[model samples]
Target: MSSLVFDRALYRRRLGRALAAGYPDFLLARCAGDLEERLSAVLRRFGLAADLGSALPLAAPALRGKAEAVLRLAENPDAGGGSAADLIGDLEALPFAAASLDLAASLLSLHAVNDLPGALVQIRRSLRPDGLFIGCLLAGQSLTELRQVLLSAEVEATGGASPRVAPFADLRDLGSLLQRAGFALPVVDSESVTVRYGDLFALLRDLRAMGWANALLERSRKPLRRSVLLRAAELYAERFSDPDGRLRATFEIVWLSGWAPHESQQKPLRPGSAKARLADALGVPEIGTGEKPGGEKTGGEGER
Candidate 1:
């Protein structure tokens, strides 16, 4: 029962290529800055912070001010991180000991994880009590324009289509994952950023440089037809172009923040423990479950 969604080894190779290509930093920079701001808002100093699977030095540098020590973990040994990485490790399988870190942050990663919930559980287990975890990844709606055009174009050109992009998690599903992974006070949000490109080819170049190419285990091994690509570009320019003629490519960044559970963290009230009745807040009569409009119980007589 292999539940893997991505080819980890292939993705690592791609990540290595991205580093060699001088990976674009705009999205990483944005996410890293946001991670720092969110961590800063906590006001508590962290003794140790780890940047998990970010594949770069972005989060580590930003975390230095808030933590006494920061660990930069890279996905590939030859990722050219040089002094940037303290260790090379896998995000799916963290190498840290239990309760070792006071904070952990990942930027623009996690979307490629084969078992995201399991990875999150490991992240929680590695954190000290009340330790914070902040991360951002591409949401399901990321690259909507590219996804649509590619699928439509492929179908039109070849009479069928295969996955050309990886499937990303939804915001609500991510929030639920946090809770299921034993994270306390989980918070998830999404911000959509639309980037303009001269055309689909320009966008494809950026995606390749980002190491965000299709890594799904279920992806087709066959090369995309040149005709399909040409059709996709044409459709992209036709459907997604602005008045100025630049094509729009949306990237929805989903931010997830949570803390390791501790006694001090707020807890949900137990069922049937509310001190006030619903009627009191709504200024209306409260009807019992399965009761009639005249206050009659479904299996009993009406109250006098």
Candidate 2:
């Protein structure tokens, strides 16, 4: 996988260009707001925390007074303005000491990591026992319409299509990753944001500005042809436009929270150790599988 590593150098360059261009803030603003909302629900006080991969400068302010102090850690130092990020580090190779941080927060950045499982393991190791980790990432279903349109346009215009969008992790994959990384009480949830655009160009601009364009390792090196680009725009408008002729773009943000293993944290019950049956809790009569409620055999009229 190292041989096919993501072009982080190119990714940084695009992000830098986007920041200099004064690109749109619609997505980043929304992500920051979502992160703030999640941060508000965390009642426990943290002695020290790290905000990793923050696309904006909102993490510190959102976590102010919530944590004793927060040190910003970002992959792109220039992506944020006036941020006190003490370290510029990569997700796959976190620079923090093991078991040093009380909490860690990542804002819409983990999805781009080439070694997601390895990154999660690094995060797990960085936290102290029972330390909390909460983050959000763009899910696999995000921007489905744009991806479909772009592929169709390329295939029709050039007789073949290339990978134009990086693959994102789904909910199941994310939950399993946390567990595999040894996090306890892992929680995964998703929130979908639908934004209307004046046209395809508007959506593209937002993506570029957010520093989230096609950076796939297997992506085509050849520049997109003008004909294929125009076709994609037309298809996007034709297929995904609302009644007002604006394009609909979906951004499914998956939020995940987990805690490092600790003896004090809650643990699941062992198999077959429950004191009460599920049926009893629901106030329903217990019946074995293939048996009726009245203890009769199956294939009866009441079965269906």
Candidate 3:
């Protein structure tokens, strides 16, 4: 697997801060906490505490029979003694046996991964039959207004197009990816959250703290000009500000759920149960007949 184009260390630090902010009503917030708190929540939600520690090799039991496990492929030299399995490696190339895990999860991750499909495939491979995988990703519609302003301002100030932000998969495309990755009974949905900021800079700050910076393949060599930035800020405020005079930043959260294949759930469709042909139901003449509804035999030239 290729290394992510974005700065991974910087991203992790930003994500840590964002998670620590504890934004209410956000799905990511629910899973952000110390290992014990996070594990307890997961256990309570799934209602599977018994034998959870044993079932998960790298897990530790916490309050209410909750457990936490951190599996990494490579060992971190800096990491101290802990139960957390330091399997530090790429998610796209997991070092685990096939069908070993019951559940897999990623929180505010995978967006920066270069090979998203490959990473998903690896996750699927690690799960047992009927296993579950849940994750969140930043989609195409997120930060739409900011992107437009940046592009327009860059072109106007620089007299050329600078590197644009990375392309994100739309909802439709994400759904197709789930199916293509061999997840059965796949379901995909999205939620657009509007975060209001006093100004454009505040929004950018939050975005940076959330580990979401422009990771264009071809980044600009020169520093951004103050004039260009000011113009961009003005454009952003004028175009995307709400009635309250606060700039609105949209973050589209995509929720994906799917189950692995199971024989007990498989069933063939009933024969001859499908809908009738459209031509037959509408009483329309068949194309090869070359005749009108009035029963006139049109010539070959007329048919053309």
Best by TM-score: 2
Among residues 3 or more apart in sequence or in different chains, the pairs in candidate 2 whose N, CA or C atoms overlap within 3 Å are: none
Off by over 4 Å in 1: 80-82, 271-304
Least accurate 10 contiguous residues by lDDT in model 1: 77-86
Best by lDDT: 1
Rank the candidate models, highest lDDT first: 1, 2, 3
Kindly state the number of residue pairs that clash in model 1.
Answer: 0
Between prediction 2 and prediction 3, which has the larger TM-score?
A: 2
Better candidate by lDDT, 2 or 3: 2
**Cα misplacement distance, residue 202 of candidate 1 (Å):** 0.4
- The lDDT per prediction is 0.88, 0.83, 0.60
TM-score of each prediction: 0.89, 0.92, 0.69
lDDT of 2 at 37: 82
Determine which window of 10 residues in candidate 3 has minimal summed lDDT: 48-57
Candidate order, TM-score descending: 2, 1, 3
Lowest summed lDDT window (length 10), candidate 2: 76-85
- Stronger candidate by lDDT (1 vs 2): 1
**Judged by TM-score relative to the true structure, which candidate is superior, 1 or 2?**
2
